[model samples]
Target: MKIDMSNLKFGAVEKPEKIGNEYFAVVPYFFTLKCNVSSMNDDMKKKIGAAVIQKYGKNNVQYLAAEGAYLINARMRACAISPDRKTWKFVILEKEYKSQLVKVLPKKILDKI
Candidate 1:
Protein backbone atom coordinates (compact mmCIF):
# COMPACT_ATOMS: atom_id res chain seq x y z
CA MET A 1 0.00 0.00 0.00
CA LYS A 2 1.18 3.51 -0.81
CA ILE A 3 1.03 6.24 1.85
CA ASP A 4 0.09 9.81 1.14
CA MET A 5 2.44 11.83 3.27
CA SER A 6 0.50 15.07 2.75
CA ASN A 7 -2.50 13.58 4.56
CA LEU A 8 -0.47 12.36 7.49
CA LYS A 9 -0.50 14.69 10.50
CA PHE A 10 2.04 15.33 13.17
CA GLY A 11 1.47 14.01 16.66
CA ALA A 12 1.15 16.34 19.67
CA VAL A 13 4.32 18.13 20.66
CA GLU A 14 6.03 17.00 23.82
CA LYS A 15 6.82 19.30 26.71
CA PRO A 16 9.68 21.68 26.05
CA GLU A 17 13.12 20.79 27.32
CA LYS A 18 15.78 23.21 28.54
CA ILE A 19 19.45 22.69 27.86
CA GLY A 20 21.76 25.29 29.34
CA ASN A 21 20.08 28.53 28.20
CA GLU A 22 18.14 27.16 25.22
CA TYR A 23 14.70 25.67 25.18
CA PHE A 24 13.75 23.25 22.41
CA ALA A 25 10.47 21.89 21.07
CA VAL A 26 10.41 18.22 20.23
CA VAL A 27 8.10 17.24 17.40
CA PRO A 28 8.20 13.72 16.11
CA TYR A 29 6.75 12.19 12.96
CA PHE A 30 7.28 8.71 11.62
CA PHE A 31 6.07 6.18 9.09
CA THR A 32 6.79 2.67 7.95
CA LEU A 33 7.00 1.00 4.51
CA LYS A 34 6.69 -2.72 4.24
CA CYS A 35 7.95 -4.79 1.30
CA ASN A 36 7.87 -8.45 0.49
CA VAL A 37 11.45 -9.40 -0.31
CA SER A 38 13.54 -12.48 0.07
CA SER A 39 16.23 -10.63 1.99
CA MET A 40 17.65 -7.29 3.00
CA ASN A 41 21.17 -6.94 1.74
CA ASP A 42 23.74 -4.45 0.49
CA ASP A 43 22.24 -4.22 -3.01
CA MET A 44 18.89 -3.25 -1.56
CA LYS A 45 20.55 -0.66 0.63
CA LYS A 46 22.26 0.95 -2.38
CA LYS A 47 18.98 1.20 -4.28
CA ILE A 48 17.21 2.89 -1.36
CA GLY A 49 20.16 5.16 -0.74
CA ALA A 50 20.17 6.19 -4.38
CA ALA A 51 16.48 7.15 -4.21
CA VAL A 52 17.10 9.25 -1.12
CA ILE A 53 20.03 11.01 -2.75
CA GLN A 54 17.96 11.67 -5.84
CA LYS A 55 15.22 13.30 -3.77
CA TYR A 56 17.23 15.11 -1.08
CA GLY A 57 20.43 15.62 -3.08
CA LYS A 58 23.65 13.77 -2.63
CA ASN A 59 25.10 16.37 -0.27
CA ASN A 60 22.20 15.92 2.14
CA VAL A 61 22.14 12.13 2.35
CA GLN A 62 24.58 10.14 4.42
CA TYR A 63 24.89 6.39 4.53
CA LEU A 64 25.91 4.69 7.75
CA ALA A 65 27.08 1.30 6.68
CA ALA A 66 27.65 0.14 10.21
CA GLU A 67 24.04 0.86 11.09
CA GLY A 68 22.53 -0.24 7.78
CA ALA A 69 20.74 3.09 7.57
CA TYR A 70 20.65 6.36 5.71
CA LEU A 71 20.54 9.64 7.55
CA ILE A 72 18.46 11.66 5.09
CA ASN A 73 19.07 14.92 6.88
CA ALA A 74 19.78 16.28 10.30
CA ARG A 75 16.20 15.54 11.28
CA MET A 76 15.19 12.57 9.17
CA ARG A 77 16.30 9.03 8.49
CA ALA A 78 15.31 5.91 6.54
CA CYS A 79 16.44 2.68 7.99
CA ALA A 80 15.90 -0.77 6.53
CA ILE A 81 15.71 -3.98 8.50
CA SER A 82 14.43 -7.52 8.33
CA PRO A 83 12.08 -8.78 11.01
CA ASP A 84 12.42 -12.35 9.77
CA ARG A 85 13.85 -13.64 6.50
CA LYS A 86 11.17 -12.58 4.05
CA THR A 87 9.94 -9.16 5.10
CA TRP A 88 11.73 -5.85 4.52
CA LYS A 89 10.81 -2.88 6.66
CA PHE A 90 11.82 0.69 6.08
CA VAL A 91 11.33 2.88 9.11
CA ILE A 92 11.34 6.49 8.00
CA LEU A 93 11.35 8.93 10.84
CA GLU A 94 11.54 12.68 11.03
CA LYS A 95 12.05 13.78 14.57
CA GLU A 96 12.98 17.41 14.46
CA TYR A 97 14.28 19.66 17.18
CA LYS A 98 13.33 23.33 17.79
CA SER A 99 10.08 22.94 15.82
CA GLN A 100 11.72 22.67 12.39
CA LEU A 101 9.33 19.93 11.39
CA VAL A 102 9.46 17.75 8.28
CA LYS A 103 5.81 17.17 7.48
CA VAL A 104 5.93 15.21 4.25
CA LEU A 105 7.74 12.56 2.32
CA PRO A 106 7.62 12.96 -1.42
CA LYS A 107 5.45 10.54 -3.38
CA LYS A 108 8.28 9.98 -5.84
CA ILE A 109 10.57 8.98 -3.03
CA LEU A 110 7.98 6.62 -1.61
CA ASP A 111 7.47 5.05 -5.02
CA LYS A 112 11.19 4.61 -5.49
CA ILE A 113 11.60 2.99 -2.12
Candidate 2:
Protein backbone atom coordinates (compact mmCIF):
# COMPACT_ATOMS: atom_id res chain seq x y z
CA MET A 1 0.00 0.00 0.00
CA LYS A 2 1.06 3.56 -0.68
CA ILE A 3 0.89 6.34 1.80
CA ASP A 4 -1.21 9.41 0.95
CA MET A 5 1.32 12.15 0.41
CA SER A 6 -1.09 14.87 -0.67
CA ASN A 7 -0.59 16.60 2.67
CA LEU A 8 3.08 15.95 3.01
CA LYS A 9 5.07 18.40 5.10
CA PHE A 10 8.83 18.56 4.93
CA GLY A 11 10.88 19.64 7.88
CA ALA A 12 13.45 22.42 7.77
CA VAL A 13 17.02 21.78 6.62
CA GLU A 14 19.77 22.93 8.91
CA LYS A 15 22.65 25.05 7.70
CA PRO A 16 25.55 23.08 6.29
CA GLU A 17 28.83 23.08 8.18
CA LYS A 18 32.34 21.80 7.87
CA ILE A 19 33.75 19.42 10.45
CA GLY A 20 37.33 18.20 10.03
CA ASN A 21 37.30 17.35 6.30
CA GLU A 22 33.57 16.81 5.87
CA TYR A 23 30.49 18.93 5.32
CA PHE A 24 27.28 17.94 7.11
CA ALA A 25 23.72 19.12 6.84
CA VAL A 26 20.81 18.30 9.13
CA VAL A 27 17.18 18.17 8.16
CA PRO A 28 14.07 17.90 10.24
CA TYR A 29 13.57 14.14 10.57
CA PHE A 30 10.95 12.27 8.53
CA PHE A 31 10.78 8.95 10.39
CA THR A 32 8.23 7.69 12.91
CA LEU A 33 10.43 5.23 14.83
CA LYS A 34 13.91 5.55 16.29
CA CYS A 35 16.11 3.53 18.59
CA ASN A 36 18.08 5.29 21.25
CA VAL A 37 21.21 6.71 19.70
CA SER A 38 23.33 5.62 22.65
CA SER A 39 21.82 2.19 23.10
CA MET A 40 21.72 0.38 19.76
CA ASN A 41 23.43 -2.89 18.89
CA ASP A 42 25.09 -3.68 15.53
CA ASP A 43 22.06 -5.49 14.13
CA MET A 44 19.75 -2.68 15.19
CA LYS A 45 21.95 -0.15 13.47
CA LYS A 46 21.92 -2.06 10.18
CA LYS A 47 18.17 -2.35 10.35
CA ILE A 48 17.85 1.37 10.94
CA GLY A 49 20.06 2.10 7.97
CA ALA A 50 18.02 -0.28 5.84
CA ALA A 51 14.76 1.29 6.89
CA VAL A 52 16.11 4.63 5.75
CA ILE A 53 17.29 3.23 2.43
CA GLN A 54 13.97 1.57 1.76
CA LYS A 55 12.25 4.91 1.94
CA TYR A 56 14.96 7.15 0.51
CA GLY A 57 17.13 4.97 -1.77
CA LYS A 58 20.71 3.67 -1.53
CA ASN A 59 22.37 6.66 -3.15
CA ASN A 60 20.63 8.88 -0.70
CA VAL A 61 21.60 6.87 2.33
CA GLN A 62 25.00 7.42 3.94
CA TYR A 63 26.58 6.78 7.32
CA LEU A 64 25.16 4.01 9.49
CA ALA A 65 26.11 4.11 13.16
CA ALA A 66 25.45 2.58 16.53
CA GLU A 67 26.95 3.66 19.85
CA GLY A 68 30.14 1.71 19.18
CA ALA A 69 30.96 2.15 15.49
CA TYR A 70 30.04 4.01 12.32
CA LEU A 71 29.77 2.42 8.89
CA ILE A 72 29.85 4.33 5.64
CA ASN A 73 28.08 3.08 2.52
CA ALA A 74 28.91 4.86 -0.70
CA ARG A 75 28.00 3.59 -4.11
CA MET A 76 29.18 6.89 -5.07
CA ARG A 77 25.75 8.88 -1.19
CA ALA A 78 22.03 10.04 0.13
CA CYS A 79 18.84 8.36 1.97
CA ALA A 80 16.42 9.14 4.80
CA ILE A 81 13.59 7.29 6.55
CA SER A 82 11.54 7.99 10.22
CA PRO A 83 11.06 9.42 13.74
CA ASP A 84 12.29 12.88 14.46
CA ARG A 85 15.62 11.17 15.21
CA LYS A 86 15.72 9.10 11.99
CA THR A 87 17.81 11.48 9.89
CA TRP A 88 21.20 11.15 8.24
CA LYS A 89 24.26 13.22 9.09
CA PHE A 90 27.05 12.16 6.78
CA VAL A 91 30.00 13.50 4.82
CA ILE A 92 28.06 16.15 2.97
CA LEU A 93 31.06 17.18 0.86
CA GLU A 94 29.35 15.34 -2.03
CA LYS A 95 25.89 14.59 -0.64
CA GLU A 96 22.51 16.26 -0.73
CA TYR A 97 19.66 16.33 1.75
CA LYS A 98 16.88 15.11 -0.57
CA SER A 99 14.39 15.16 2.25
CA GLN A 100 13.66 18.78 1.31
CA LEU A 101 11.73 17.38 -1.65
CA VAL A 102 9.25 14.96 -0.02
CA LYS A 103 8.26 13.27 3.22
CA VAL A 104 7.95 9.66 2.04
CA LEU A 105 8.46 7.71 -1.17
CA PRO A 106 6.00 5.19 -2.70
CA LYS A 107 6.29 1.42 -3.13
CA LYS A 108 7.05 1.69 -6.87
CA ILE A 109 9.88 4.10 -6.13
CA LEU A 110 11.33 1.71 -3.55
CA ASP A 111 10.92 -1.26 -5.94
CA LYS A 112 13.00 0.33 -8.68
CA ILE A 113 16.00 0.23 -6.38
Candidate 3:
Protein backbone atom coordinates (compact mmCIF):
# COMPACT_ATOMS: atom_id res chain seq x y z
CA MET A 1 0.00 0.00 0.00
CA LYS A 2 1.13 3.52 -0.77
CA ILE A 3 0.95 5.58 2.40
CA ASP A 4 0.64 9.35 2.04
CA MET A 5 3.11 10.69 4.57
CA SER A 6 1.58 14.14 4.68
CA ASN A 7 -1.89 12.79 5.46
CA LEU A 8 -0.84 10.54 8.31
CA LYS A 9 -2.37 11.42 11.66
CA PHE A 10 -0.32 10.31 14.60
CA GLY A 11 -2.00 9.19 17.80
CA ALA A 12 -0.11 9.67 21.03
CA VAL A 13 3.48 10.00 20.06
CA GLU A 14 5.11 12.94 21.70
CA LYS A 15 8.14 12.88 19.42
CA PRO A 16 9.54 10.77 16.65
CA GLU A 17 12.51 8.48 17.36
CA LYS A 18 15.51 7.63 15.25
CA ILE A 19 16.35 4.00 15.67
CA GLY A 20 19.27 3.75 13.25
CA ASN A 21 18.75 5.41 9.93
CA GLU A 22 15.08 5.65 8.93
CA TYR A 23 12.58 7.99 10.60
CA PHE A 24 9.18 6.80 11.89
CA ALA A 25 6.14 8.63 13.08
CA VAL A 26 3.73 7.15 15.61
CA VAL A 27 0.08 6.84 14.72
CA PRO A 28 -3.16 5.72 16.31
CA TYR A 29 -4.95 2.41 15.83
CA PHE A 30 -7.71 4.23 13.98
CA PHE A 31 -5.43 4.79 11.00
CA THR A 32 -4.65 1.13 10.50
CA LEU A 33 -5.86 -0.46 7.25
CA LYS A 34 -9.35 -1.92 7.55
CA CYS A 35 -9.30 -5.26 5.81
CA ASN A 36 -10.06 -8.85 6.65
CA VAL A 37 -6.90 -10.89 6.82
CA SER A 38 -8.93 -14.10 6.46
CA SER A 39 -10.85 -12.75 3.49
CA MET A 40 -7.71 -13.16 1.39
CA ASN A 41 -7.17 -16.38 -0.53
CA ASP A 42 -5.20 -19.18 1.04
CA ASP A 43 -2.15 -18.56 -1.11
CA MET A 44 -2.26 -14.85 -0.51
CA LYS A 45 -2.82 -15.27 3.20
CA LYS A 46 -0.07 -17.81 3.29
CA LYS A 47 2.26 -15.41 1.56
CA ILE A 48 1.50 -12.55 3.89
CA GLY A 49 1.51 -14.88 6.84
CA ALA A 50 4.85 -16.22 5.83
CA ALA A 51 6.29 -12.76 5.56
CA VAL A 52 4.82 -11.91 8.94
CA ILE A 53 6.07 -15.12 10.41
CA GLN A 54 9.49 -14.63 8.93
CA LYS A 55 9.78 -11.09 10.19
CA TYR A 56 7.73 -11.73 13.29
CA GLY A 57 7.17 -15.44 13.86
CA LYS A 58 4.75 -18.37 13.59
CA ASN A 59 4.23 -18.74 17.30
CA ASN A 60 1.19 -16.52 17.86
CA VAL A 61 1.58 -16.38 21.63
CA GLN A 62 5.28 -15.68 21.46
CA TYR A 63 4.88 -13.18 18.66
CA LEU A 64 2.24 -11.27 20.58
CA ALA A 65 4.17 -11.20 23.82
CA ALA A 66 7.50 -10.40 22.24
CA GLU A 67 6.53 -8.13 19.36
CA GLY A 68 3.89 -6.06 21.10
CA ALA A 69 1.28 -7.14 18.60
CA TYR A 70 -2.07 -8.54 19.62
CA LEU A 71 -3.23 -11.99 18.67
CA ILE A 72 -5.16 -12.09 15.36
CA ASN A 73 -3.90 -8.62 14.47
CA ALA A 74 -1.67 -7.86 11.51
CA ARG A 75 0.28 -4.76 12.37
CA MET A 76 1.80 -2.90 9.44
CA ARG A 77 4.11 0.05 9.48
CA ALA A 78 4.10 2.51 6.60
CA CYS A 79 6.90 1.52 4.26
CA ALA A 80 8.55 2.84 1.13
CA ILE A 81 9.36 0.24 -1.49
CA SER A 82 12.54 0.36 -3.50
CA PRO A 83 14.14 -1.71 -6.24
CA ASP A 84 17.13 -2.28 -3.98
CA ARG A 85 15.96 -4.47 -1.12
CA LYS A 86 18.24 -2.63 1.27
CA THR A 87 16.21 0.56 0.90
CA TRP A 88 12.91 -0.67 2.28
CA LYS A 89 12.06 1.33 5.39
CA PHE A 90 9.15 1.26 7.85
CA VAL A 91 8.02 3.41 10.77
CA ILE A 92 7.18 1.69 14.00
CA LEU A 93 4.39 2.89 16.21
CA GLU A 94 4.45 3.63 19.97
CA LYS A 95 7.88 5.21 20.11
CA GLU A 96 7.95 5.97 16.38
CA TYR A 97 11.26 4.24 16.13
CA LYS A 98 12.67 3.87 12.65
CA SER A 99 13.68 0.28 12.09
CA GLN A 100 16.57 -0.91 9.99
CA LEU A 101 15.92 -0.93 6.27
CA VAL A 102 15.05 -4.43 5.06
CA LYS A 103 13.62 -6.12 2.02
CA VAL A 104 9.84 -5.90 1.86
CA LEU A 105 8.52 -8.85 -0.10
CA PRO A 106 5.48 -7.95 -2.11
CA LYS A 107 2.29 -9.91 -1.56
CA LYS A 108 2.52 -11.41 -5.04
CA ILE A 109 6.10 -12.56 -4.61
CA LEU A 110 5.30 -13.91 -1.17
CA ASP A 111 2.63 -16.18 -2.72
CA LYS A 112 5.11 -17.63 -5.19
CA ILE A 113 7.69 -18.22 -2.51
Candidate 3's C-alpha lDDT? Answer: 0.37
Model 1 Cα RMSD, Å?
A: 16.0
TM-score: which candidate is best?
1
Choose 1 or 2, whichever is better by TM-score: 1
- Tens digits of per-residue lDDT for model 1, 43-113: 77668767767766787666655655565542234433343424544445333321232223333223323
Each prediction's Cα lDDT score? 0.44, 0.40, 0.37
TM-score against native, each model? 0.32, 0.27, 0.26
Q: List where candidate 3 sits over 4 angstroms from the true fold.
A: 1-35, 61-113
lDDT of 3 by residue, 1-113 (tens): 11111223434632343334443333333222222344455566556556656653465312222332323333434433333434544433222232222233333322322
Best by lDDT: 1
- Which segments of candidate 2 are over 4 A away from where they belong? 1-38, 64-113
Model 2 alpha-carbon miss at residue 53, Å: 0.5
Cα RMSD, model 3: 13.4
Ranking by lDDT: 1, 2, 3
- The residue-by-residue lDDT of candidate 2 on 1-113, one tens digit each, is 11222222346654554443434444343332222333566677678677757756776555523333333232322223322334553322122433433334333222322
